[model samples]
Target chain A: MKIGIFFCLKVWNMNAKIAIQGIKGSFHHQVAQEYYYQNVEVDECLSFEELIDSLMSGKSDQAVMAIENSIAGPIIPNYALIDKNNLHIIGEHYLDIHQNFMALKGQKIEDILEVHSHPMALLQCMEFLKKYPNIKLVEDKDTAETARRIHQNQLKGIAAIASKTASEMYDLVILAPEIQTINNNMTRFVIINKADNFVSKNEINRASIKFELDHKRGSLAAVLNVMSDCKLNLTKIQSLPKIETPWKYSFFVDVTFEKYEDYAKAKALLTIMAEYFKVLGEYKNTKP
Target chain B: MKIGIFFCLKVWNMNAKIAIQGIKGSFHHQVAQEYYYQNVEVDECLSFEELIDSLMSGKSDQAVMAIENSIAGPIIPNYALIDKNNLHIIGEHYLDIHQNFMALKGQKIEDILEVHSHPMALLQCMEFLKKYPNIKLVEDKDTAETARRIHQNQLKGIAAIASKTASEMYDLVILAPEIQTINNNMTRFVIINKADNFVSKNEINRASIKFELDHKRGSLAAVLNVMSDCKLNLTKIQSLPKIETPWKYSFFVDVTFEKYEDYAKAKALLTIMAEYFKVLGEYKNTKP
Candidate 1:
């Protein structure tokens, strides 16, 4: 009995508590399950703000936050959240999104009066939903939560756009499969923690950074030149306006390189060139 | 009678039909009222897609579209919509956003059980709403529409976060004024027409352009160099992923200049520097 108790304690310690922005069977939940090998205890949050609070308060070991989607572009607020909270991204995962329309087992597509889902999910499946002009599209907080609600309430004449996992989990049937308009739908999620530089230097190949340039002409151009000279390949560049400084902007950039030394050299140069510079994260490149 | 009929026809021809997303009390409607000096007729649309259809089908003379917000960032899909539909932006307007929480007359703030509004409006007023933990926040299609519904239905416990115009138009009483977290909240709107170059050459000081660069290192830097060398001030830059070719991006840029000739010169140089370049619009600078 003593040995068994010790074994159970060790196993519990091995299980990671991962924070996600939705309930079970959500895309965020799916990411948490697929990205980690060990057993994960999910800390479900209704909003991104709540998810950050969970991480900040030490309720969870780490978090999996969706950063951007191929069809929807970046979730800009998440970037600001991560930056403001000083969270470090340790890794990333790209998930193929397949939005499925699900409802009660007895209902056909014609029987549904309303469809509820996350706004982004609803936007993605617009082409499919447009055919059923009579059905009202309502925005909900989460995709899987809606499926769960339909199941728990035994609601009729209502449907949800969610994942296949959600249908299986909530005992719902898929009315339409792969309903997203775009075939190449993908969402990139970042695994973030409170600590920085968690990954070994040699294994790191990508970095996310933010910088501000002066009002001089071609200042941005000059910075990009320095990045090019350092042999960094710019993967993504997004400019967010500084609200306090009306027209001024700060650029959030992602770069990937083959060598750590090259990234380091570029970082050193950028620190000197930019009026404000901060490294949000350095992680292994997930791209093949 | 014949003279009156001819005069009525002439007067009707002079009334410009402006297409806007949302109903009469929406920010778009306010823009329509403020931006044009002519006798204007408003064509209301529920969605941006519907607004585009109205403009494309010639149901309206031109459209007013919100492109970006000070706090919420750019409405990126609008850029893609404009680019894909080949619509030209002929003018711009800036509106100060003031979100107000309103409810049925005689109801105190404590009496409100739910709040309905556009997601953007809800987000902007989060700090104020956070204090009302018992109130449920629901997302709707438009802010003013919710206010209208609350009034029409006599919803005693329901409130809405909308503009002051909405409250006055719907006869609701404001419970909380200026609930947005930021004081300098503003939204930038663009006046789009089907025809290109509606503004004359001498008056044009700003332009919106899109370009794609080769995969070569420093190619973007090289293009920016041309703009800077030609004396153009880069105001905004947003990169949209090319869905067909994953990992590649197309940059949408806005630039303002002192002289139309300087803008013209930079446009020529950017055309030569970029692999693919297109001028999305050329209009007078609205910024002071």
Candidate 2:
């Protein structure tokens, strides 16, 4: 019956392959479904490298990657991956992450002796988990995988902290819903595609750019000053330390503008001022 | 013999109680030992929160917290922890991190079936571990604790990726020294104290500050202009999402200058320009 529903939807959204990191019912899967058509073909990758590989190799048309979490900050290595892969970020997404604690059917909260989930997920729900002193928290590779394992193994005293979709997929019961300490936690994801075919509809208010600077004193400050002069609003700035160079850093800045010409002017000045610069993406600002 | 040396050194550096985030031979322990006078009392805390608690509760005079790593990037939550706890960053230290692969004295590389370490250490040594496909990587709470457990349990066919200090403390032999993918990986640790009593010795050059801007567009850019005007070199900038507020962000910046008065001038202007501002620390630049 579920397959019938899936088939009907797949027929409606044919040939839309979206790659993400994790299995079905995972946060990435949820993001892909929500961002794109609901029944788009899902290309699941075990790791971020594979996710990018799927996109680069033409196996997947697009990819949804979690760029940062409100609680954990940016996934720095991912920025490096996207930069090195030269993938174009076409859009951005903000996911309201609600971590749920689940266990086998007929099991009460007291019956859970051990809890398992991804390390980051475990960290988010640490405050609530502390109340259950007897339950040991273990870090697994994936939250959905943990839920599936408990369901398959019929583990009587074990629970998994995952999403509600995972609980439904694995036929488990949610012992405690919304376990994350911050009730309003959110994660930002970036949508990437192989081609930079994003045509600005005069609504492109935000852009991401990466640039390298010399070891001079006011190099970055000068760039920021030019951005202000051009009427560009610097929303975010991240400094990634260059791998080979010991102390040098490459700056990634996300800026927004009222007019496209202003952003273009800032880009023109930055091209001359920065040693090396690349605009990762320019998209409609989703967050005001 | 080691106890005798420790007692003599303790006498030389009396009344120094340092708190760190792991067991005796963990990275935090090594950092504390390297940053402070050797043989000063070491108060081991299980987590970063506990480490801060030790300093706040008068159990330790100072704390050494890892702020960033070359390979893994910044430990962002620690920055939030320090900022929220109202702790003072007294100084900074850079430690060359060398992750070593070790096991029982008689074991060879091929004999090990499983490797265990902290997740971050495992990630650093991922390239090297790929060579041994048969070995399963396990993430433990602490690298030093994992080594100690292997020795205590008489566990064979199991190796641990930790520091040389851990091997010595656990009576293990180094099977492969410096197994980290990046040979020159370094971790930047901030020396924090409860009391903001660090007096500049005519060499103060770096200052870490936190500020919040009104949702106005060019507020951050304006702050950068002030820093430039004051001859302050912006070294690092990190934006942390304000938890209560949805889309707003607070910036944490580290800037260096030749003259202290220039930094004071920048601070004086920033205080009036920003909605919320705090000087996290002002210390002598140790990153030459």
Candidate 3:
């Protein structure tokens, strides 16, 4: 079934272009390279919206978007963007994120007065940075771009917190390796397309879904009970405020099951029970 | 009951100092003034960590932190901070956040080449910015600080997207009023303190809780069913990864009930069923 769906999807497009949200050496670029072929040409985007626009315009066959990070949690607006743009999640990837503090050659940690990186990177490295009281934390647009800028300017007393790949790309010395607070930091990225693309593989034990229930008492619990009755295990759930309606919320849930028929029963029940139910993707369970 | 709690809490401290994450005229400062007293002394911090630190040091009586926004969604790390620092959500305030595009006097949108604001504000104003293809969106550290810099330097072809009060305070002209995508853009700010300040009043119809369920097949579903059985409505739920444990996750839930007894029953059941369960706060439902 997976091969059959892929054969049909391949008939419409001869070339597969990947879209990511930054230039080379970025975490998004790294994930795109790992998920797709290393030789594949990636359409780099400045923002998440631009990345989705590239796919919508047919400039890219698939877009790799970071949906959630182990340390930073969910990137909520991207979920809204996917819903609004009618994008479908076809696959998911988990990438380990490591931030290395790099500086100009021969500059010690004490020599650095200001360190720059993405706000999220700065946040993840807060524990390592707390030791250096004299150093100032600055938020930059991109982690890799900050390293590139520091290299181009050859400025002293400045450092960057970015990937080790970025440190090598910019010819900077790694002042502190793995500066993130957690050692097992990972980000979950989703492969998205313009339409529903699901392949019922025999090993398809996990599914991502979005749905809304009526604003009544026990509405959500009813859905959960349905899933439990169908023998589906709810792995993750997140509630997002519906923009059109002010206070009402829509839920995004990922459920896992050993048997396919159990998931089918739950999906059918949820479709009848939910207002705007959508199966974003059916993929293998990657996370433990 | 709430009055009694307030009386005891007030006797411990004479003056109430409010800690916010930005300078005066920021949206946080505005929320602090409105939630507390207009004459409340504000302790400004550079970052959210500092705000929490101020609370821990007893430098401020309470801290006002933005938890979720209608447009931007939840600030995930703040949830983690509240959990890690053992802070309690004493109250909540919903602030109408209006982002105005401001520039030096006599500058039009067409004249703007670069626009700077906090990343979240820039994201909220993306739709209005789509009209100008020439303008470059820049992310700065703080929204009000960006406006102050633009006004102080008298920069041309540059504008800042910030609160209307920021433009007025910085003496900048408002090029566009309420440029955010949604007119009903409001941010839900939670008032937090270091201790458990819940009063369990008769009018207490809402609660915030943190709990970790057993990683079994139907653990979460069972807890939800208990809440439903007790006549409680789950309004919001978020999952945060346990810091020490790699794959384990803890759930944060906010529920509303018509009768306080029903909530008590649900809370008692959850405490017995869940591992490491804690009631972050019990307060009135302020949202519509």
Candidate 4:
């Protein structure tokens, strides 16, 4: 009880600033805004791995990593760092990934001969890219930088796959508004911090854990059955291979328990789970 | 019997062609070679997400996602995709991420006033960047692409951060070889597919799992204890917040164990891991 109280006090003293990857106006920047609010400062990094490193090294108090998106799916490279760094997920942020094909003012859509953006941005605009065959597709470092590139170069024949913020920042006109091929394009961001930070009240519906199962056949089935038999609703499931194994994976699962009772039951079922696997952590989620 | 024969006959038919995100000679390209070998055909996508989509659509038999580098640490964005994708990890690849500082054929390192590359490439060459503080740092997309960009634009007094392959590909001169700030930098890649195609090898020694907890105190300790009791060594651990909850995490773990007895013990411990969490999956590593 003392430790818990001390931990909360420690949290209260923290600046709680959330670090985000990308320059200002990047999607991660917005997600950090959603969490850090007026009092928090959003720290920027050139790469996602550095963002986590900054947090792990005491440079920042927290971080938000783009996990998965509606059209593109998850960010796979981030998983390696999240694994390498011991940062814990404290919250989740779902941001609307609104993309725009922006170009310099007075540059007509027909004037565009190339589209540049972060790979995902270009891909989200793939269907649009197909429509304009002459517009060669290229990738920039980030969505915001894409706009910055066109503006700095004063390139008339180039457009950028970027966000509304990026367009506004670079004074670029939107040739194609919401050019993302999918209307449902959304990126889920996971806010991470040192393992000792507060889990937060917002985490009631969230849980996180890790485990390993035997290599034999039916081992995976037995592991999944633990969730199904307990009647827990699984929202997401993904597995990554260990560096030492062949054709085996360690799985990550997100489960939605309609009631607290189900959550309790699911936790209880982990006892049987540990019999066949290795449990990592079961922690609550916080929304930002 | 039929299933066993079907499995037996399927052994020789498994020809996995993996897609990776990069141009011809990025670190990811090298890693793909580690897994699929010279016989394998590599399909290059511009983005990591596209590689995942390629696997999703069966456009590529498998996809290789760079997870982390030893000296550079984790590639955190890839972790998000791993959590978001339905693809299973069937293998692992490690590539040395060596960086070369390059420029136009006639240019000397002393003559260079600007450096360009993907931001991460720049970061990997941070020490190099620092040494030439007067030089402007320009961010391009990929290391190889950056080299290509330098060649295409014919920028004066400029250098690029890329691999030896980029120098060879673009016919540029390596102004400074092995200029990465981190000399020991090595990247780990995961070859993912829709199917769990493992031809059992007795030497596989590691596994991975993801899980969520019941939002209780001591949950992490409870799970860690399981690994400790079973003597499983954890090489990596990452926690991402569960979106459904405002402040909870789903933890991913990479644990090391040897042989049948150890694998069984690890699984047994994971079964009980649920007193507070959910069990995700146990995986075998395929890194050669």
Q: What order do candidates take by TM-score, descending?
A: 3, 1, 2, 4
Please give, for residues A183-278, the per-residue lDDT of candidate 4 as tens digits: 766677886767744553334466555556655434444555656666665555455544433334565556655455666776677756554333
| Candidate number achieving the greatest DockQ relative to the actual structure | 3
* True lDDT of residue B173, candidate 2: 96
- Docking class of predicted structure 1: medium
Residue B208's lDDT in candidate 2: 87
- lDDT at B49 for candidate 4? 62
Report, for candidate 4, the interface RMSD.
10.9
Off by over 4 Å in 1: A1-12, B1-12, B37-39
RMSD, candidate 2, Å: 4.8
What would the per-residue lDDT of candidate 3 be over residues A31-126, giving only the tens digit for each residue? 877766566678888788899999999999889999887877778888888888878887788988899999999999889999988888898899
Second chain only: TM-score per model?
A: 0.93, 0.92, 0.92, 0.85
Off by over 4 Å in 3: A1-15, A198-200, B1-14, B198-200
Return the number of clashes found in candidate 3: 0
> How much lDDT does candidate 1 score?
0.87
In model 2 chain B, the worst 10-residue window by lDDT is B1-10
